[model samples]
Target chain A: MRYVLFLYAAIAFVVLAAGSIILPDWAMFLFAMALAKGLVCLGIVAMMRGGVVSFGQGLYYCIGAYTATLAANMWGLSDIFLLTLLSSAVCLIVGVIFGPMLATYRGIFFAMLTLALSMVLYGTLSKMSVLGGSDGLNIAPPTFLGWAPEGRDLQTALYIYVVAIVVIAGTLMRIYFDSEQGLITLATRDNELRVEYLGASVRKVMAYNYIFAAVLGGLGGTIAVLALGHVDPEFAFWTTSGEFVFVAILAGYMSVPAVFVAAIILEVVRSFSNLYFPNTWQLSLGIFLLIVIVTLPNGLGSLLSRRKGGKT
Target chain B: MSAGVLEVRDVQKTFGAVTAAKDISVSVPKGAIYSLIGSNGAGKTTFVNMVTGYIKPDSGEINFGSRNIAGLAPRLITRLGIHRSFQIAQLCNELTVEENMLLAGAIHHDERPSFFRHAHSAAARERAMATLERFHIAEHRNRLIPELSGGVKKLLDIAMAMAGETQVMLLDEPTSGVAADEKFPIMDLVIEALRAEGVTVIFVEHDMDIVTRYSERVLAFYDGQIIADDTPDEVLLDEKVQRYVTGGPA
Candidate 1:
């Protein structure tokens, strides 16, 4: 465990330094966007343990971004660090209220409920002019304690994502997923009847996991919103939730770090395909997902583990 | 506190027009290896489920030790010292044997079963390992549940339940449908382990040798209520229990 932490810390340091010095504006933005998406996928994997595919992640994600957006626009709460804290709190609170109803259902019913919730948010936000409606609202360049991160355009975003990555979110969640509560999540997925018999509460475990996922999702949403310097209701659509699920599936539901790799591959592939054949990027993505699902039943990390264990 | 580990009053449970368990009353004393024997659908499991708090009784009062825990959630009841193993092997098929045992211990140590305030620390691991050793499955700890044989799966399920800080254990057919050769070993291990913990064992089984061998007393169920509840010898020798078993009491 100590060795893995050391290795991850070393890697984070290298990436952080490189982003500030050698990386171009586009690369930095891509890196930050990938990291933000990676955090959202972390929440998805947390839910995935229960065999629940929540399509309402975008609803919570949008709530986080919009909370920050509203804070800045209507309330003039302009400090980025404080806004980040407030955004995460709001998302978690909303998840707390919605969790019991949303988590009580599983399989397709769960999926549809989340989708409906996200769509409702999208509809309501699109009609609200205070949120700037479809045109969206722009955020001013954020000051962290009045000292803006010394980076241009996308570089600043990459720095923010790097902060999110190192903020103990991943480490804390790693411990969580290894706990007995984590086992309850998996047990509930496997057999709710047996887990109950084994002295577990399926509803409580599901609710806790849902709320944790919302916190992570909101954190991701806050980072993403801050990165783009804008917020809009469309960001919280069911389609966006679909995209996060897609990333999680492609990454597999085991390790949190793998999500970043999956996110980067997604961005690189989508952009490359769009540049060459803009009309067929969606088709290419579909084919890629199908291939990954078929060839790697455990996801790409399985391949990495196989190689490491010398079992391939 | 009551001398009985579990004191069940006249419990009633119904499924619409169908009465699953009716006026079922039984008191399990401390340190008794009690077995419930009955044909399928005889309310053996329903009684177990109700006592364990999986299903709420329509009307009943259950006293575990001193506290009335009729409608408490399974986790809360478990903490108050009741554990259970299911008929259909409750081990997580995806995780390893050791992982499953550790998870069982983790509920008491880390996380509130609330999944918050995780107590997943080094101290928890030591206790989890000790529970694994008690079941003699420590050697096969790394193997996943699906890969294990039926007997090993049964062992894992028992170990998982034993991991909880329980004073009473309700095992629903601990050796049900396993190979005849493997049945005794599994039962002996589970009963012995739970006994070591000073936990009262109440299990439902159809096998008569098992009932007579490990159980000090037996509770016979007929049609949704306990008809003959006494020692294995007493219940087996009773005319009413014999009639029900010989297909005359229907």
Candidate 2:
């Protein structure tokens, strides 16, 4: 069953990569950015499955972008792969340090505490002048093993790279969802007491999950900075985190591929609305969310899953 | 006191003005079937909670094989070979019976509980299947938990607990939601299953029939203390126990 999903993903990404050559620069850039945001949404889905909805996911997102920017500027580290790895390393370290506090909380307390943490980052970043303050940092063009693609080539390479990363990460996360550690999230959400009695620490399970979410969110931020060639304090803003949560709700936590699909659809809708409706993009997004909630309560993936005759 | 496998040394707990447990003490011998009986608000559940590490006594000792586990975390105590089921059949409602059982088996894995290892390994699958069959729920393995009846859920709850290496099995009202006719059969099967594995059974039960029939010893609780600890016949016939716990003629 997982093999089929992987095969479908490989085929889909291959088609997308091939299509990137013919696709307009703007279209490719937009899609790549959407996939980057999908990584953040995927992390949110992981936390959501564990019965936690972090409204402050932007905290790690900003940390990744800022870390990549700082490393590139201070040390001349411009490898895209290294930047991505650095984002994960930084977020993981932060997660381990803060996870104990966050994992000890649940429900609204968990959500609000996450939001508060992200807001603290936002405040700190906005006030710090050396780190670019409110205007944020400009990233140097990233090199791929000493080969830096220029202009259109850069866009094309980035599009393909982002797609490949999302596909690989999605597949790995899907395997995790099927594994024991993954199923324990459902148990943790269902009955924390029962999971404890079963010889698993609920807080530790949640703490590890929080760290995973942080790493994924940080990875997304790194990719986003690479795509845009800039980073800002706004990345840690509450509304930015809210947008990721919005996409997670639109995607549903049931399937891994659903996260990417949701992110792409959201980006398409937002861009198209910004082009057509001008001032009503938020309104359009709100309407889209309402429709999804009222019609497909489990999100668009449930619709696709039902059509394929698979479990939702 | 040291002779028993599980011993409680004057455990005490208080919630503000109300005292849930106060200087309570008891010892459970190895492989012994003991029933705890009391009226509502009699501190029976609180006692069970403390024994299982869900509640920490204010000032007392909980010795499981000479290890003082009074303030230990519930999972640590669980790892110490003590397992329990909830009174309300707490389960992963969205998952299939097989998945839930496999989760229990996976946690018991000796690989230091890693995500890198396959959760549904061949060994874990074999153990889950074997246990499911033993509990007579193999046919419902693929079925989601919400589809199962109350009795089956209760049975599966206990079955999931037994998936690990348990020395002491704490069942909180195992037959509460079960039908009257199915209650005895469920208890009989559960007690038999646990005893077959040489597990010491300590269950909280409100039903007199289940207590008098299945348990060799009974602990009667009243006003946050153990009023009687003796054979079922003697405890049930005790005048104070009958008046306070069983609501007999004062």
Candidate 3:
């Protein structure tokens, strides 16, 4: 049954890659950006499974973008794969440093601490004149294993690359959620005392989850920077983190695929509202969120889960 | 006495002005079933908490086997072979009964839980099912905790606690919320299961009937101290136990 899910994911990946050839350049870029942001939301979903909602995920997101951009600019490393690897490694180390401390907190304290950390990053980045300061830095177009695709080809290459990464990440996350450690996390969410009495360390579980979320956030930032061609302090800003939280809540933690789907829906709504309403796009998004929350309290994932007549 | 499996010596615990445990000490013989009887705030739960590492005694030596387990974290104590159940059944309300048992089995059986191994692997499922069957709750294995009857929840809670390698099992009011008719049946099932595994059973109770029926020995508590420690019949006849604990004729 698990392998069957992976097979379906592979098929979806192939279709998305093949179908990208017919999409216009602008549409491809938009979708790539949406998927990149979806990766960040995936990190939030991982932590959510352990009963934590990080409000400062943008801290890792911004760090990843800056890591990739700085490595490319200073070291002249232009390969997308190498840049992503570097960003993930850096984020992993940072996560180790912070995860233990963050793991000690829960509920509003955890939320506020994460938010504070991201805001600190935003503030620090804004004052650093060497790394473009408040205006941020622009990244050079990426090459794929020495093959530099140009014009519309570049957009398609990036779209396909993002699609591949999402498939791999999503599949691994699904497996993780089914693992023994994963079930322990879900148990911790329900009764931490019982989990402790059962001889599993709740703190250790929470710490490991925090580290995983950080790596996912970093991966998302790397992809976003590659597609957007820009990295700025705003990536670590409160509003940026808020948007990721919005996607997480909208997707629900039950399904991995629902996360990206929710992200795409948000992007589409934002794009259309920006184009048509121009000034009231935020209000439009607010109303859309209200509708989703009222109609589906468990988020879009519950709709499919309910049809199957089982909890995921 | 057969070698004591759990030995508590001069344990002291004070919560602000109230003395919860004052120089209390007891040695539980291996494989013996002991019942603790006390009124509310009489420090019955406090003693359990101290032994299980939920509340560290102000000063004491809690020796389980050869190790002093006092002041240790609950998880560490649990891993060291002392497991416990709550007065109110502690269970994952969102997960099914089998899943809860599977989680406990996975954690206890493996040196450490695997990140990639499926939680409901064939081996884990088999173990979970066996434990459930032993407790006579196999029929409700797929039902969620909230959906189970109070008696079933209590049974499942005790079953989960028994999932690990336990030398000593502390059951805090195991039959508290259970129906009167169901209490004896539940106690019989629990004591039989624990006895079959050679686990030392220490349970707290207000039900004198249950105390006399299931336990070979009884400890009566009053004002944070043990007033009577003897066979069930002898403890029931003590003057202090009569006035302070069971409210029976002295």
For this target, which candidate reaches the highest lDDT against the unseen true structure? Answer: 3
Which residue pairs clash within candidate 3?
none
Give a tens-digit lDDT track for model 3, residues B1-250: 5889999999999999999998898999999999999889998999999999899999989998899999999999999889999999999988899999998997898568988888888988999999999999999987888888889999999999999888899999999889899999999999999999999999999988899999989988888998888999999999889999878863
What is candidate 3's CA lDDT for residue B226? 88
| Cα lDDT of model 2 by residue, A28-73, tens digit | 9888888898998898899887889899999999999999999999
Tens digits of per-residue lDDT for model 1 on B1-250?
2377788998999998878898988778888789998888889999988888889999989998779899888777877778888888877777667667766776655345534333344666677678777777778877777777877878778777777677888888888758999999888888887788778989989888888899988888888888888888888887878877534422
DockQ, every prediction: 0.42, 0.60, 0.79
**What is each predicted model's overall lDDT from 0 to 1?**
0.78, 0.88, 0.91
Task: For candidate 2, write residues B119-170 as lDDT tens digits.
Answer: 7677778889998888888899888877898888998999999987899998
On a 0 to 1 DockQ scale, where is model 1?
A: 0.42
Each candidate's root-mean-square deviation in Å?
3.2, 2.4, 1.4
In Å, residue B245's CA in model 3 sits off its true spot by 0.2
Query: Residue-wise lDDT of candidate 3 within A1-312, one digit each (tens)?
Result: 688978989897998898687888878888898888999999898888889999999999999999999999999999999999999999999999999999999999999999999999999999999999999999999999999998888888889999999999999888888899999998998899999999999999999989988999999999999999999999999999999999998998888889999999999999999999999999999999999888877788787663223343
* lDDT (C-alpha) at residue A261 in model 2: 81
Which ten-residue region of model 1 chain B has the weakest summed lDDT?
B110-119
- How well does candidate 1 score on lDDT at residue B63? 91
- Runs in model 1 lying further than 4 Å from the true structure: A148-154, A157-167, A305-312, B110-125, B246-250
DockQ order of candidates, best first?
3, 2, 1
Query: After aligning candidate 3 to the native by TM-score, how far in Å is the CA of A128 from where it should be?
Result: 0.4
Q: What is the Cα-based lDDT of residue B60 in candidate 2?
A: 90
Predicted complex 1: CAPRI docking category? acceptable
Q: Assess every candidate by TM-score.
A: 0.91, 0.95, 0.98
- Greater TM-score among 1 and 3 belongs to 3
